[model samples]
Target: MSAPDVFAPARLGPVTLRNRTVKAATFEGRTPEGLVTDGLIDYHLAVARGGIGLTTVAYLSVAPEGRTHREVIVVGEHSLGGLTRLTDAIHETGAAVAAQVGHAGPVANGRSNGVKAIAASSMPSPLSMQMVKAATEADLTRVTKAYVAAARTLVRAGFDVLELHMAHSYLISSFLAPGLNRRKDGWAGSLENRARLGRQVARAVRDEVGDEVAVTAKVSLSDGFKGGVTTADGLAFAQLLEQDGTVDALQMSGGSSLMNPMYLFRGGAPVKEFAASMPLPVRLGMRTPVGRSFMKTYPFEEAYFRDKALQFRAGLSLPLMLLGGINRRDTMEQAMADGFDFVAMGRAVLREPDLVNRLQSERVESGVCIHCNRCMPTIYSGTRCPIIDLELAAHRDPLPQI
Candidate 1:
């Protein structure tokens, strides 16, 4: 088959996106009360209006206890009304909507959540500075049910896609990583055992949604550290998903939200700025060498994950979306040429919500973003480009004299 057009319509399972450029999921930090707020709605509306083919609402927790923090929206009956409104607004802008659903696992903030976090093994949670409990068989069953419930809620909210988040060392991903999953049960040891949770969750969601919506997954291509999910293991798990015929596409990503987040981002880490965003006690700790080492920096490169994603592309027949450091039009077209079905962008679109439209019109200048990654720290407040906010502030009329 010929290479697909980057600017043309593309089908993601039952949903046909206006184009192949997706506004990749980024934690919006807008749902302060664990419910849909106006800020969350407007955050997606801006991206939808900016002409993204699909705008993904990030990190919606499958269960209340599964949240990364208390502020994350839990997909259930309580929040269904607000979620429906949010999706309706986005659809009106001619863009399809996706909700990224997952359990934070060891990555959850136990202190903020008022519940003990669960993981494949008992471990420390840096976010909550608390010990994470090893997930029991009962917990795993509950989580699978939670994923199914969330999938149904998303479909009812008029979402065109259900992006299962099985990456970033979240619940299912921790099970995949040998470093994190020390279980001696059927859910661990061998690759098939370790991969069981992710495959189970995907199949359950697919079964619940059926042909009503596109089902995709943000799959880990690597955990970016030795003893974590290696490239070989990641590729094998992706092929298994293909074999299961569950996900319509896989959005190949890297790094552990638990171990090494910068491995996926590939740019400046902005340690001090990140420190300032934390609480007083944690802020002081982040200044230490130990804290600095945890948030390590990686040099920036365009299409940083392309080489890794190609491995999965070669191994699986299913569609794949290449993510990480996709900023330029040429890069997007090059990805299509290289056999990727779509390109997903996060920071670049955060810098310019209308970037897809600008690239489509051939009016964009490349490298408009500096890749300093300062925007990442702002996820604690509201995810945005601080530079753009500054520029807009400067151009605004001066405040009236006190």
Candidate 2:
């Protein structure tokens, strides 16, 4: 009969979190040369200091060809120092740290990585306009090894959590979606077969990490496109993940950056703002009918994923993390009441890193992000809200560095 406490400490696998809030992974374009930077550490430090259970470092590519950007952090010897410092910095703030590891699949930027982007099958990427080649069996084996290696690296660097990314239409997500993964091989066709790569990665990472850290996964509840993975199938996939006995938790997310990104987070799409951040050619392309189709807007609401995530909670016994539209005490409380073990936030934390602290102290009702999604384009430059970082606005370049 009482509202569940959103700020109380909770168990997340091998670690005990200070609070139930998690700083969800957001791509920080600060990393250059596929290595860590002071900017990246500082970003997470702010979130950790603001008071959250864990802050996830975003999108570490397993292989160079899998990278969406040339400057994305690659789990390698060269990045050890930066990664260590990032974990140490978050730890100093008394917070757990996580790294999101995955291959970009068709989303891989051929212009940036100097290699043809890969997918479950040969298909042209709607976002990249690059033809993706089907990954060979050898490629899958190498990628699995890379996942294990990356998990080990994160644990060695003092991270408390490792989030295997199987969402957002990435390589793993592509395999899960029949629309993209048209292969007749063992890795395609049925949902069980399509989920093989993701399950393998989760299992490999869990095996490598042993018990040193919590291993979780992010899954797309829906591809938000027709003929894509359906909600019924997504629930089945979530059950499959738990049955696989690899990940400690399941985090729900959706939307395809290559298709309906607005579906991921229901909100206003800053089309002109996105176009303004690109080069002349890309800018012109954005103005075209085809380019304009990429930025479809969706209505914003608090706890947008609650209904869908609640279905997952009802069907599975594994701990689930509720994400999307968690910007206030009420929404966070709703998640806790609905049986989600943890709540993950991105734009809310980005706008106010201390939002968790504010919620705990009862200082603020909710975050003031406005759901404009103007900050979306800044991921290509540096992910800072235009409203909060005035300096960035003045120096906004015509072409954001890819």
Candidate 3:
């Protein structure tokens, strides 16, 4: 059989995407006040107007304590109006929108959020340099309810999809990682128990939305280090998700936000740039031996995660979205030929939001992104490509709202 066309319409749950290309969720750094701003809307508008099938707004935490920093949006009634406006604007460009909901867990900055980080078990939080407390049963119940609340709010905001962040060593993924989760209670030990929180959240969100929109998950294929979830354990957890019959698709990703993040976006590490972006105290820490260990580097390759994701593709029948270092049309076509349902691009799209349209019209060999990964540090102020002139970005034509 011929490979499925990369530009053709595709169904994700009940939503029909204009094309199979998705602008995967990358923290925009536009919401500095924990609420939507013109910058945030314009960021997604750039991708929508450029012709992405779906553009995901990233890192909407379920609770304030769950936020990675003070500036992260806490999905709730307070932010409803701004979120609604953001989604409506994207729909005007004829592209679907999704919300990436997650709890930062050990990844949360306690100093910034003015709350202690909560994890499956107490551990030293490197972000805040404080001891993270173990989540009690009451805390678990509150978090579950928060997930449901976030789902309802996203649906109300006109989002066509809800992607539960179950990867990157956040609350859910942290619980699933044996090295991070040392709890002896029902939420730990066996793989089934460790996976319970993620399954419950997915089922709850699905029950709340009930086909109103697509329900998907971004799950880790591995934690990218020893003592983390292995490929075997990751696959087993994915099977549990499939058996639950709740999630419509799974976007495969890896690495721990708390530890080895470069495992997910392999390229130049940009260690010096990352240090320079931080405050003086933290800057000094980043230059230390231990700090350098946290910023591990890896070589870049197109479809870097394809070999590992293929294992899930072969083992499970659920729809899968292939991510990590996809910068060319042939790579996307290859994913479709391999039976994947969608292809998600992060840095490549950030480098050129209009690359999808260019790929269709210009027939370019590949995107202009060099995978320098310098853009990684810019997430602190505003997620942007330095190659693009700041003055030009400030003066670009704005899209008309319908």
TM-score to native of every candidate shown: 0.96, 0.94, 0.95
Give Cα-based local distance difference scores for all models: 0.89, 0.84, 0.90
lDDT of 3 by residue, 282-304 (tens): 56545555466777889999999
- Those runs of model 2 whose alpha carbons end farther than 4 Å from true positions after fitting are 1-4, 279-291, 390-402
Question: Better model by TM-score, 1 or 2?
Answer: 1
Worst 10 residues of 2 by lDDT: 281-290
Stretches of candidate 1 off by over 4 Å are: 281-290, 365-367, 397-402
List, residue by residue over 1-402, the lDDT tens digit for candidate 2. Answer: 775577888888989999889999989989866788888889888889999889999989888888986878888777878899888888888999888888998778766677888889987654455577999999999989988887777777888888888887789988988988889899999889998998888888877887889989999878788756677888998898898888899899988866668888788888878878765545654555546677777899998888888888899999989998888898888788788889999999999898899888999889888777888989878898888877566778777678
Candidate that would win on TM-score: 1
Q: Tell me how far the alpha carbon of residue 299 in candidate 1 is from the true structure, in angstroms, after superposition.
A: 0.7
